[model samples]
Target chain A: MGTRAAGQVGRSGPVAWMALPALVFFLVFGVVPLFGVLVLSFTQWDGIGAINPAGLSNWRSVLSDPGLPHALWVTFEIMILSWLVQTPLSLLLGVFLAGRQRYRAFLAVLYFVPLLLSSAAIAITYKALLDPNFGLGAGLNIGFLTQDWLGKDNLALGVVIFVVSWQFIPFHSLIYQGGVRQIPTTMYEAASIDGAGRLRQFFSITVPQLKYTIITSSTLMVVGSLTFFDLIFVLTAGGPGDATRVLALDMYKRGFQANLMGPASVIAVLLVLIGLALALILRRLGGSTTASQQEGA
Target chain B: MAVATSAQATSRREAPGTSYGRKLLRLNWLGGTAGWLWLVIVIVPIYWIVITSFKDQSAFFAQNPFALPAEPTLANYQLVIESDFPRYFLNSVIITAGTIIPAVAIAFMAAYAIIRGAGSKFLAGVNGLFLMGLAIPLQATIIPVYLLIIKMHLYDSLLAIILPSIAFSIPLSVLVLTNFIRDVPKELFESMRVDGATEWGMLRSLALPLTRPALVTVSIYNGLGVWNGFLLPLILTQSPDKRPLPLALWTFQGQYSVNVPAVLASVVLTTLPIVVLYAIGRRQLLSGLTAGFSR
Candidate 1:
């Protein structure tokens, strides 16, 4: 590859040669497969049967399927729950840790434990703890507390939402912490001097300063919600009669287990579309805050 | 209390409604308590798993759930080790290396090219492609990947898992590595060119050594994801012998569903290697991650 640029190596020439392998990999793996998915989406194909053109039928079936609506509802439920729970917790911890001088490093590392563990590992730990028969909760004789968390139809998804938020809070916290650290301490000092209490100063200063980070982290959470599969897959396997059957899990079930490739691709495309739309909205919202803040300053 | 700084004491004694200018001067007990509580929540499950790994089945049932093992035994661990744990571990090692090495290597080149060839339309297009790759979730792509692997006759092999994992990881690696490479001063490249260094020579001598930490960071970051991956292994590979640790643990549960101690012991064994690596090399890994935000 470098041979082409051996004698006539312009500024871009060698660089292009260096980039060739990576470009090829993405083209083959990333770009081509994406197109393959799109083409495959419009065709009805079981893994073994002759592929037949769907003529909009696959899209129609996927959209019209009763499961789709329920899964969508459940997915959004998890999203809203995670956002509501994960955001405040991450921000609180992030802001507190950034402002403190003591045990900051120790606490950050400790909090980061769940982030590093595989989702599977975390699922197993929780499953063990929430075990109906002899789990930690049950073993401890907390009658009201223990309720077959994973096995029940009503509680399984809530437990999943809690666990997923727990696992991801640290990641979002680090982002928020960085944003908080960048805010000038002088701003807080001035606010305090102006008769603003800690609560008042937090709203007036910390929230405004962290606008962009909040948007970024929120977009990530939204996307995480859209594509959540591992925890659901690991713990309950979307069980107790579709109590936790999320879109990603639905896609997996349809594609792999049920062998419905077209519908699965439809689900995938829908997920990507939702993710893009949300990201764009967040970016616009985040950008406006920066502009407004600049004017205020 | 006697050793408290004047600023800390003053801030604490300041009236509740009246604000104090001294910030970070006093411990915010409310926030401190909240932070400590969150830490306990995060660590307790891990503590339970680790402690439970040592207890025998009877001890695990008889003793308190969070209690230390009264008659700690290595029997569960031994049973797991004898039951194909080594094979599963080896498979994971091979798969992780297969994914990370190529993904990071190719990404380095691409990042280098993107930085040095900044003005080129093609390079810019490549950069955009990697960005697009970031938004594509793994769930949507699995059906196609499964079909492609079957088409290529690579299904159920470690190669199958490795290929798609590398594809998914390259976008982030390229993004991070490109940011790092752009920070390498232009003068370094200019000086190298003046010495008649070819692009290959320049990359070997200058770029590789400079971005070495990013390389390690990308490798470990992607390696860990692949190591813990469940979806790909669950769908792509079918053989019990070929399953990685996560899948192995999942299957281990099914086989030993009655034996809770053994299942947790297997989980502990699966996670131990990464935990050790994290404990030792955390600062370097996290700093590399933290550096990404500055850009």
Candidate 2:
């Protein structure tokens, strides 16, 4: 036994070594930089400047700044709009595709096309389509249809939300579809014997069975909205008087554009905290609902 | 809404069901038709993009935006080729390949170690740190990363994007594959141990082979993300020659503002590679997406 225990100890050392390279890599890029930025949040420095000490000044300013609150509000607004649009639409589509239909497979592939293409590609395509000079308007010869979609502050955020929803609905739909597929056929048959109509069967069966899926998708959508950079950046560049400037974009503007590392780091820390907090909360919600979903059907 | 087909009508009668049966059947047809219509709305923009790419400048202005091209021309394609899109293509290919290979390899080995060392508190803590990675949005890290890269003199180089992309990617890769590895039967490890195989050898023989599907799934998924990645390249690199396709497309929109066909043509070219990958690995890419939550 002593010899076997010694042998296990010897083997464990090599097992630890396998993780060393990755551990070192993460330390350099992941953990170390994470803390480095946190420390940088407390100091005043541009990219190449000497680090000058600041006592809660960066945080103090960011907290009182109007941009922070407005950016936060817009970010949550996008999150709410996305959740409202994507969740139900995806649920309906998921159920429709999972039904015994002929074109289910083809439709699944088709719906997923937006996700396959890059956000850059999608944004540019839309930009051309919405261009007043030579876009859909000039081609269609309808003067009223020629409004500058991305240029108008009021319309740009909504347009961005619409485009983003188009790309992500399929993703959320797939989650709901996975959940729908897991519902046992026997349960449906049991409902059929009791004469539950399709709508009744759907409401009582499909929705409740998808509790965890809904929670998971909602978590992803919320966290994802907080980091809305690529599509909005490509579409509007936080455009037409900062209409679509999300917190993530604000972080970029402060850090890279303005060369204010201290305050930018503060935003970075907030993004990390907000994202992790929401995900953890929603994950717990998802976990608790799993039992109810399991007991549902 | 759609009228029920004769097939459904016949089936409903053959089943001898109540009126509720007819309603359900009608609902299915209605729902399915709505799904088809929504899909058509989604595909219309793609159709417009492809058709617009083939039109000449004057013909594009003359024609209806959604209409078919009057006389399709390859000149736009030629123009894009001559304008150095190929260089950007090469750069993107290099970055994607560079980032995915190392990220996946490092992540796979780390995942293996984590799974094997599950009893160790240190490994669990490491796993927690990786989860924390998903929370650190790239925008948050780009500032420090910019400074760090410049200090290392990797700024304005593809290595800048490659290194951070690899770093950000590892957390997800490790999290995903760790879940898969945890599901691998422990009895296999014990059997290999009985034969005196080292952990590395076991990883090579057992883990690599057993996790082939997950590995492939991971590769295509990460490859897509890296290929379509815009921010890192935009912030990190500077030279027009060093720019990737997304940045190339951005600059293309400006230079070819008058020649819209050339710009759309470039868009098509940039997206073509992704389309091909999607065609081949649609299932793998998609199932990989849901794999995280399902696990």
TM-scores of the models, in the given order? 0.91, 0.91
Candidate 2 residue A68 Cα shift, in angstroms, is 1.9
Candidate 1 residues lying further than 4 Å off, grouped into runs, are A1-9, A99-102, A189-195, A288-297, B1-17, B21-27
lDDT of all the models against the reference?
A: 0.80, 0.80
Residue A83: error of model 2 in Å? Answer: 1.6
Candidate achieving the largest DockQ: 1
Q: What digit string (tens of lDDT, one per residue) describes model 2 on residues A1-297?
A: 322444676555666677776677777777777777888899998877788989799999999999999888878888898789888888888887776565786788888888877888888888888888888877898987688888898788888888988888887777777778878888777666555567767888888877777876787688888867878887888987888888898888888789898999999888878887887777676666454332121
Q: Tell me the alpha-carbon RMSD of every candidate.
A: 5.5, 5.5
For candidate 1, write residues B1-295 as lDDT tens digits. 3334334545555574434434333336656777888988888888888888898888888888889998888998998999999999999999998988988998998988887777789998988788766655645677778888888898889998988888888888998898788779888887787788977788889999999988887887788889999889888889988899988888887788777888889988998899888888777676666555423
- Residue A20 lDDT in model 2? 70
| Candidate 2 chain A least-lDDT 10 residues | A288-297
Model 1 - which docking category?
acceptable
Q: Model 1 — TM-score against the truth?
A: 0.91
